[model samples]
Target: MTDPDRPVAIPAVPRPKDRPGRAPAPETTSTYRLGQGPLRLPLWLRAVILACCLVEGLLLAAPLLGLGSARAVSLMLGGFWSPLLGGGTGLYPGQGAVMFLTYGLLHAGLLHLAMNMISLAAVGRELTRMIGAGRMALIYLASQIGAGAVFALMQPQAGPMVGASGAVFGLAAALVGHAAITLRRRRRSMAPLVRAVALILGLNVALTLLMPSIAWEAHLGGALTGLALGLIFAILPRRA
Candidate 1:
């Protein structure tokens, strides 16, 4: 028998084997990805450059390959001044419009083709980057048409004209306009852009004077159209 003040001993409890415990969460680490933009050329630039090269190559090769006469090709595929003149306007309505765009593809010689293609690549890449492929195309087409119309108005009696000079000038002017807008956005004056544009115009004028065969009218028209388009684009919201 236990005494009234004596302590009692308690039985030890067994540990459970199947009790659930909190599991450590799966380990995770942060990851990052780098973008590829500068390395890639836009599809529109590739297509246009390739097409220009191919068209010029085929034109040059046609005579050697016995496919056709180079002169005949130039007269037929090249833009003619006939529509501008009062001579045989029998061509269906809007035919003249088609010729305006095609004229840009035709060049007088290998040298002519080379110069135009080089300028196109240089200026086109910049404009493409600035305004994107679609807008670039619109500006180009409109420039071509404006050049043709201006040339016809100024030189209705002039001989057949061909080459991408008008379009090239347009791209140059477009660059100037773009630069001006960008500078203005930063609270800067447009003097630099204006000077650059003036220099370009002066050079073109000298070239025209030196080479009377060059169509000054077309260049001026294209440049004006480009300036307008660039200003309009500058005011619009931009997207990536």
Candidate 2:
């Protein structure tokens, strides 16, 4: 046997290799890619928003156009006519119910009217078609009422809350849900979509905090409700 050395050489320790490199990614915004869709409103949605807007405008202008009162804003907001005006609680049987529905039809100004119409003309139609007119209508009314509830509770003194923003935000939320599912089913990650949505949410939040002109409560409420409804709709069986 060979004589052992004074000290046996120690085996060299191995260092761990670095982790596998991830694919390189470029910096970008997601809303720029996802903020829109195929441009067209579905028929039922088009008919509804358009007809509603027309009726709302007609009613708002009615007093001035017919009764010649510069202060006839009452009709515009859909109120109960006084008993002296030939009604109890100033309302017909369905008039109070109309109040909930009418506010969406009315807007504080022309600009308010146009913005909502554009949104409805774009996304509302698709919602009605994909989910069916009945469910779509339900979502719209529910979104409006939900948003209205938030406004009535939080900002009652802020004058009558108007516009289709609540329902529009609901549509946005629904789209987000649908897209999320689509990506997942394809085994794709939602990082890009999430980041984009986060940016949108952040921007909206910032605006809400900074500006007194926006009704972000309705936006939040509508988005939440819409997301929930969309999730339910996705799992529900279609009616024959």
Instruction: Please give, for residues 204-234, the per-residue lDDT of candidate 2 as tens digits.
Output: 7886787677787777777777877877786
TM-score, structure 1 vs. true: 0.75
Query: Candidate 2: TM-score?
Result: 0.64
RMSD of 1: 18.2
> By how many angstroms RMSD does model 2 differ from the true structure?
18.2
Q: What are the per-residue Cα lDDT tens digits for candidate 1 across 3-66?
A: 5454444434444454468564444444333342453445765676677667778877887988
In lDDT terms, which candidate is top?
1
For each candidate, the alpha-carbon lDDT, in order, equals 0.74, 0.65
Worst 10 residues of 2 by lDDT: 79-88
Off by over 4 Å in 1: 1-41, 82-87, 90-94, 189-191
TM per candidate = 0.75, 0.64
In model 2, the Cα lDDT at residue 105 comes to 62
